[model samples]
Target: MRQEITSYLSTIKNEMYQLTKFLYDNPEESFKEKKAQDYITKLLLDKGFTVLKNYMDIPTAFHAQIGEGHPKICFICEYDGDIKKGHIYGNNLSTSISITAAISLAKVVSKISGSVIVIGTPGELNGGSKITMCKQGAFEDIDAILISKPHIYNIENPKCPAILPLKIVFEDNLSGNLTSMDAYIMTINLLCQLAKGFKPGCTIENFSISDKVCVISLKAPSFDTAAEIRHQIEILTNTLGELIGLNHEVTLAELPCAEIKTCKTLNRLFAHNLKECGIIELETDKCVTSGSTLGCISNTIPCVNSYISILKDKSIPYPSSEFAKETLSEYAQEIGLKAAQALAFTGLDLMEKQNLIIEAKSELIVQSN
Candidate 1:
């Protein structure tokens, strides 16, 4: 079955390369991925998917469905690029692999008994399309969602915690002869200490301070953990302000952790499929702690966001361009084919092995309840 799926995907090699290259060459920012959306929609439509353009009323978002009946498996794709910095985060690679995988699976969906859904979610960096999709009930009918991402290891689960993106502003005038720069530096140093004191699976990422404003991103394993961290930060900020005679102000925005309620059976099946597809090492390094749009969907439904390593070696750091290149290279095409094979096999298993999907849904119900 894996070889047959690979053969099917091999037939589309040139087209896949063209599609991947075009998207890579013309990167679009969050919420402005019109061209990317149109291209993906057309490709899926050509493969017999019922494409719903501008899905959920988001201009660049779409939901394409192929096949019919019992179990509905979803392939989540994010195409929004970092227009300013190019595909530095390798979203283009993710987007291409997802679309290619979905199409590849669609070719064999008729042989199976379930639907394959490809959801094109735009705006990972700026706009939160998955949040909107979940709120709009996009994932309500889905049985399972598969997401591919670039990472250092083949992680079935990566630590993904509830994230709080907060902006802290020191509003009061500088005390005595102190300048905003001095206050900023002092505040940052103190925050660094606070971060150092944080527990495992909690981190402060992308902390930047300028003038009287400081922006820090927080991630914790759960909502309660995040709330506790937030409270601690507030207390420490207040203490520092009082000590320096400066006023501190904080504004926070919450993002629900796409806490993956793990289904051991499904994970086992995926791991088996991945190994059969030529991947030797499988690690659960941890759950994804980084913020991902997939988190929003996973928070609402049974989803697996698999991270496949692009690096030939795990110890060395590779350039983002190399990652992008890998997504389109011949080797990448093989990886993409394997990914499709894995998802296809998983979907088939979920549809046929009633107990497996039942257990997965039971897990989601337990987590939600």
Candidate 2:
């Protein structure tokens, strides 16, 4: 079965490259991936998968299925790229790998009593469409979710910290006590002081200040801690506002991203498949971190966000033109194809082994608790 899947992916490697190149050349911003959605859905339809566009009322999102019954395995595809730098984050390659994996699994799904689903999740760069989909019950029935990203090293699972984006507005009191700018400067000083008392594993990741608004991103080891930090900041800011005769508004800038809850059973299977593909040097550090919307889905279902090496030079920073161009290189394309083959092999195993699915779900329940 592994050989069959490998052969099938090899046969379509050129087509996959072309697909990646097309997405790389024509980058679409988040929530506006009409061209990408059309191209991918047309290809999936031609390959015999039943695809439903406008998924969950998201115009750029789609759901495609190729099998039926229990142990419904899902592969998540993200195609939205950076607005200015194009496919600088390698979403184009990730999307190609996901589609190829699903197609390869579709070939052998008939032999097993399982289903394969490919979900096109857009707006990961800014809006986090997966969070909205998860809220709408998009992943309620999925047994396992598989997704991968281009990284500097081959890793089975990377620790993704919980993050909360907050917006603080300081409105003038009109009593001439102090201007909003004065309040903003005071708030920044107070926030810096407050940050010194934060517990270990918590930090202020980034922040920005405008004329009357300040946006701060808080990061913590867990979602609960992140929310607690946000609460503390709000209280402190409101108190300062009251003392200075300034009205303040605190609100969430976007959805809070939860830290990834890895399903060990699924990650082990994926690691095994990756090793079979000659990717034997896997990074084992749990502290290696990256941000991802997969954290949203992993909170409910078993999920694995594996990493494949896409950059030949390690020092090239991401979101740069050089990084974007690297994604279209031959080496990156081959790595992406290998990742797709590994992901499809993992899917094949999960479909054939019912106990694996049961164990994975059991782990999810225990982890959630």
Candidate 3:
């Protein structure tokens, strides 16, 4: 069966590259990825599968189901390419790989015996696609999810910490206060002091000035700030939380940050899975990724986010035009196929066990200062 699926993919390899070139030639943003979605749909329908256009009620978003069985599983793919001029990271290539994988999974997983869903989501750059699907109950029945990102590294252990994104304003010109600047300065000092134990698990803690100091927007004066409080450990995450909560009792302008959560599961997987995946979108080669911001790893589902790693840059393993120009060897394609192979094997194993019904839960806590 594996050989059969591989044969089917080989037959379509030229078409896959053609889709890549077409999408690369015409880049589109989220919600507007018509050409990309159309091309992918065409491929799936051609393979004796049913394609659901706009499955999540989100335009350009879809879910393709193949085979049938007890546990319904889904793999994730995003096709919206980057249009920010020079920095194009293989949206077309990854999408092509993901769709190719999906087509193979469809051909292999017998619907009469097992079920599968290929989720082509848009707007990952805006950070809301999968979450939106979850809200619509798409995840409730899903046994597991698969996703991948461009990378120079591989999946390590728990990586890409959860983050809290906050929009805050400080003002002292109201009825009771010292001054916004003074409050800001004092809060900065206290937060920094508390941030020492807050470093690793709660690895990313940064602030930036946002809007102009206009209170009229308020008449007197006020400051706009945003916080990206990111952490990996729950305890370290709460350290800053404790400080923020303690200060909130004293003044309202101490400020809060963005969607922050210390993803312990994510962090642990970061250390465990680096041998599996890497986020080349951050830095190609030189495997030792740093910083766990929501900006880094949020929508990445359950266990896979744990697999991120840093790659050795002794070779330029990026998807840039420059890298594509160097076809002097054959390892990168092999590695990419390795990703597909792993996904297939994991998915097959999941399908094999889809009928087993069991329930269990546990909590493990670790502390670091």
Predictions in order: lDDT: 0.73, 0.86, 0.48
lDDT of 3 by residue, 183-217 (tens): 45554565555556543444324454444121100
Q: Residue 321 lDDT in model 3?
A: 51
How does model 1 fare in lDDT?
Answer: 0.73
Error of 1 at 259 (Å): 3.9
Candidate 2 Cα errors over 4 Å, as ranges: none
Ranking 2 against 3 by TM-score, winner: 2
The TM-scores, one per candidate, come to 0.88, 0.97, 0.64
Question: For model 3, how many clashes?
Answer: 55
For model 1, the stretches where C-alpha displacement exceeds 4 angstroms are: 1-7, 174-183, 241-247, 253-258, 287-289, 313-319, 367-369
Clashes of each: 9, 0, 55
- The regions of model 3 sitting more than 4 angstroms off are 85-89, 156-158, 171-193, 204-206, 213-331, 353-369
Task: Compose the digit string of candidate 2's lDDT tens values, residues 253-338.
Answer: 88878888888898899999898887788885365544677787887788879888888799988667788788888999888988
Once model 1 is optimally superposed onto the true structure by TM-score, how far is the C-alpha of residue 80 displaced, in angstroms?
2.4
